[model samples]
Target chain A: MTTEKMIIEIKKWLMEAAGYIRVSLTNELTVSQKSGRTDLVTNIDEETQSFFIKKINQYYPNDRILAEEKGYDTIDSLTGRVWIIDPIDGTMNFVMEQENFCIMIAVFEEGIGQLGFIYDVMKDELYWGGKNRGVFLNEQKLAQPNDVSLSKGLLGMNAYMYGKNIHSAGEIGHASMGIRVSGCAGVELIAMLKGNHIGYISNLSPWDYAAGLVLLDEFGFKYSNIEGKPLTFTKREYFLAATPTAYAEILENFI
Target chain B: MTTEKMIIEIKKWLMEAAGYIRVSLTNELTVSQKSGRTDLVTNIDEETQSFFIKKINQYYPNDRILAEEKGYDTIDSLTGRVWIIDPIDGTMNFVMEQENFCIMIAVFEEGIGQLGFIYDVMKDELYWGGKNRGVFLNEQKLAQPNDVSLSKGLLGMNAYMYGKNIHSAGEIGHASMGIRVSGCAGVELIAMLKGNHIGYISNLSPWDYAAGLVLLDEFGFKYSNIEGKPLTFTKREYFLAATPTAYAEILENFI
Candidate 1:
């Protein structure tokens, strides 16, 4: 199927999935811990992933899946027709604030990102696009953000990285206008896309960053492993995404 | 005049002032440095403060004014119907992202806080209330936030304070679920009021925190200098506000 057609279908699924998530928020959420108390997973996360999986299997049976709650253990490679999913990017936020969490999905064919969608369910803002197709927030086509430097723009950060001063992030933060933490990768990436923030850095898993990698590319933003190496997508890696200039500066001076 | 009558008049001025500020966003702003590079003031900030001063003088000439851009120097005491204003609470955010900034106004009668308003102009959210009265966001009456503990709730921190690890704030942050920084006192305070964050700590001037002090009081949140002392409102000081349980925990264990 064509990328355009796939996006339309994916968006419909996203909307329906978001509606389900919203309704669930009004009810009690069955939450469980994954790695620790800080690393949380909710029933909505598992259910949302199952919904997407069922849809994908029905529509595109050949596609492989890498998702947060399930299907991750079954997939080992991103060679062809891979759908990377984070049913709820910020589960803790969903459980705590119910405002900053998101549903993210990215489609990769032959290890190349063909489509990406990040649905901010509560705000009803969907950021989706692909390489050469131009990115958008809902229906509004997003323009390329200004090439703000580290000294002039806000930077989004992971709380742990900032607290621990990992990779000299503390020094890098001081050089920027300020640093902000929203506890959600999708929200931080959205901030970067809209020019509200110049960059974002965190230790991110494949599901945490797949959609952002695709969306950021279309807007001239740069991203990579913390040392400017390629992301392998097989493990959690220190990640950095920033405006072109800021990205380069961070790598050269701090990382 | 009665507090209800005063609130009605003040809200009208606030709406008009917010409208003016919104309109100014599309035009070129005259920006200048205040304390340093990080400390900024724009034409909108000055004009907004001036607008409030003009309306207050016209309506209640006997009232004294303390404001960010001007009038603050003239006030020595919070006696006799004094209005404290922060024309733009997050000037840097306003100048950079054009969001997360607020127009804060708090009224004190004989050193007692009477009414407070925090207008998040971009979002059009007005958090307003007074002592012994119910607090509200827009027209919805805000309820007291859940008495969450430090370990289960998010904490808001000022970038500088968090980065410097001042007052064992870094330790306190580790004890919490996570830390978020929005670069605006009004935004952080609203988070606590809505139970999005358990607490917020930072160094702030009177204008930065006065309205929040009043509004938070109505929602049963506790506030004090970081050291558990009262706010003097006469100088810049370290400040902390949190849910009642979180407040006691921080004060007893960390502060």
Candidate 2:
């Protein structure tokens, strides 16, 4: 099938997943700590991932899967198509607030990112993009983000980034108009796409950021590790996502 | 007129103010900087304040008005009614994102907070309350927020609080589940009342937080200076607005 047909099929799968999520809000959720008490995973997270895995197998049985709850196999030669999924990106927010969380999916072929999808479940906003098509906010094509520096716009960040003084985040916190912490990487990415924030900076896992990289590329925003290296799907690292001017200001002055 | 009649009149005035705000969105806004380029004042802020002042003068000619955009005389001897208004609480958010801002109004009688309102304009959520009626989101009366400790819940703060490490904000930043920066005190107060946050900590001016104080008091949330003194409506100070456990934890450990 052509990529266009495949994308339509993927969106269908996503809608089905969202239906399960919205309908299951009242269902009892079982939550457990992962890396620590503060790091959490809920029963819905596993169920959502299972749903996507089932649909992917039914549609594209040969594709490899890299899911957050489950580990991924190394793509040493970058040969086959791989699907990266984070079922519910902000488990704590999901279990506690029942808000500000999303499902993220990214498709890559031969190690080059192709398509990305992020659905903010409660807000009903769908952000999708790829190189073949520019980024869109629910079918409305997004203009390139405003070229804002740190002083002129708000920045989204994780508290630990500043509390731990990583990469002089404290300085960046002081430099921006303000900071927003949504507790979900995909939600932050959607906010960035809408120009609600100049940028988002954090140490994120592959599942948290892989989907966003495609959208950021399509939107003409920049994303890279603090060391100024290109992002790779292989490992976790400190990454900076910023508009044109902020990318230069944060990279030069703070990052 | 009876106090009950007075409250109904206040609600009508608030609805009219909201109507004016909704209609003015398309008018070209003249923006200017205050303390800095990022500290903004827009034409709407002044106009909204003027609308309220005009309506108040037409209805209750003897009462006083204290607004963010203008100063007013104190009700000498604490004997007359005073309305405190923050015409556009998050001016930067309003001008840049056209969202995340609100109009706040509070009424005090003889120096005691009697009623308060914080309207999230874009979201169309109105939160209002007082000693007579308790707090509410739209029309639903809010239950007292969960008694979440600093370690188990999120905290809302001004960036400078954490960036400067004032009141041990860095330590509190580490202790909380996370932090959110909404860039508007009234919005943060509404978030806190809804239990999305354990509390809010910041250095806020009177108009920035007076409306919230009335609602917080009605909901049994606690507000105080960083030094654990009762808030004096007369000056700017580092303040803490908290749930039961967070009040204890932040007071005894962090603040």
Candidate 3:
């Protein structure tokens, strides 16, 4: 199928998924702790993942899936026709604030990103794009944010990392215009894409960064592990995404 | 005027002022530095303040005004009817992202808060209320948030205070579920009002905390200076506002 055609299909599915999630929000959510007390998942998250999986299987039968809730053990490498999904990127925010969480999906072929979608369900904003297609928020095309340096722009930070001063995260917060913590990787990436922040850093899993990395890349953002190494897409890693100058400054001075 | 009648009048003016600010956003903003580089003021801010002052002078000529841009020198005490205004809270956010900023107003009578209003321009959300009127977001009446403890909920923090670990701010952040910084006091207060955050701490002036404190008080929040004293509302002071449990916990354990 053509990229545009696939996007149209995916958008429909995403809107439907968001509708389900929104309706489910009015009902009681079955929440459970994941890695820790701070990490959480809800029944809605699981159902959303199932919704996406069922659609992909029904349509793209041969596409391998790696998602937050399931299918991770079945994928060993980023080989051909892989789909990465994070049904709910900010589960705690989902269960608590009912905002700031997102549904993210990225399609890859032979380790290259082909399409990406991050749906802020509550806001009804779908940020989606692909290689050579540029980027867009809902129906409007988005422009590339200015390449701002560390001192000139805000940074999105992991609350735990910033509080603990991990890797001098607090120092980096001081060096920038300031730091904002949204407690959601998807929301932070959205802020970065809108030029509200120059960079964002956090310990993120493959599902957490997959769709955002693709979208950010399309917007001319530089991203990698804190050590300036490429993400392996197989595990959780300390991640950083920023404009060129901020990325270089952070890697050289703070990280 | 009766309290209800005054609220209706204020709401009308707030909507009109918001309309003007929204229209001006499309034009080039006359931005200037205030106190430091991070502290900013724009022509819109000044114009909005002037707008409020003009209305107050025309309608309630005897009432005093304390606003961000002007009218501070003459108010020696809060002994009479007074209106405290932050025509544009989060001016930096306004000058940069154009979201998250708000116009805040608080009316006091005989040293007691009588009414409050916080209008989030971009989101078009108006959180307004008074002592005995109960709090509200737009037309919907809001309920008091759960009295969650420090360890159980998110905290809104000032980036500089959190980064510098001022008065153990970093330690407090670690004690909470997490911390969020929206770079805007009005936005943070809105989050706390919505139960998205349990607490918020920052150094603020009369205009910054005045409106929020009134609404928060209506919602059963506990607020005071870091030293556990009353806010004088005449100068910059270190402040904290939280649900009762979180406030007590932070004071007993972390502060």
Tell me the DockQ of each model, to 2 decimals: 0.77, 0.54, 0.68
Model 1 regions more than 4 Å off: B71-74
Q: Considering only N, C-alpha and C atoms within 3 Å, which residue pairs clash in candidate 1?
A: none
- The Cα RMSD of model 1 versus the native structure comes to 1.3
Inter-residue clash pairs, candidate 3: none
Cα displacement (Å) at residue A77, model 2: 6.2
Error at A49, model 3, angstroms: 0.8
TM-score of 3: 0.97
lDDT of 2 by residue, B133-202 (tens): 8888888888887778788887888777876689898778778887777778977898888878888889
lDDT of each: 0.90, 0.83, 0.89
What is each model's TM-score for chain A? 0.98, 0.95, 0.98
TM-score of 1: 0.98
Off by more than 4 A, model 3: A71-74, B70-74
lDDT of 2 by residue, A1-255 (tens): 788988898788888888888887778888899889778988788888999889889889999888889555244444689898999998878876787899999998888889999988888888998876988878789887778888988888877786566898767866888777778899788888888898988888888998998998887888898667887767777878999889889888875
Docking quality band of candidate 3, CAPRI definitions: medium
Candidate 1 local lDDT, A7-108, one digit each (tens): 899999999999999999999999888888889988899999999999999999988999988546336788879999999999988998989999999999
For every model in order, the fraction of real contacts preserved is 0.69, 0.42, 0.62
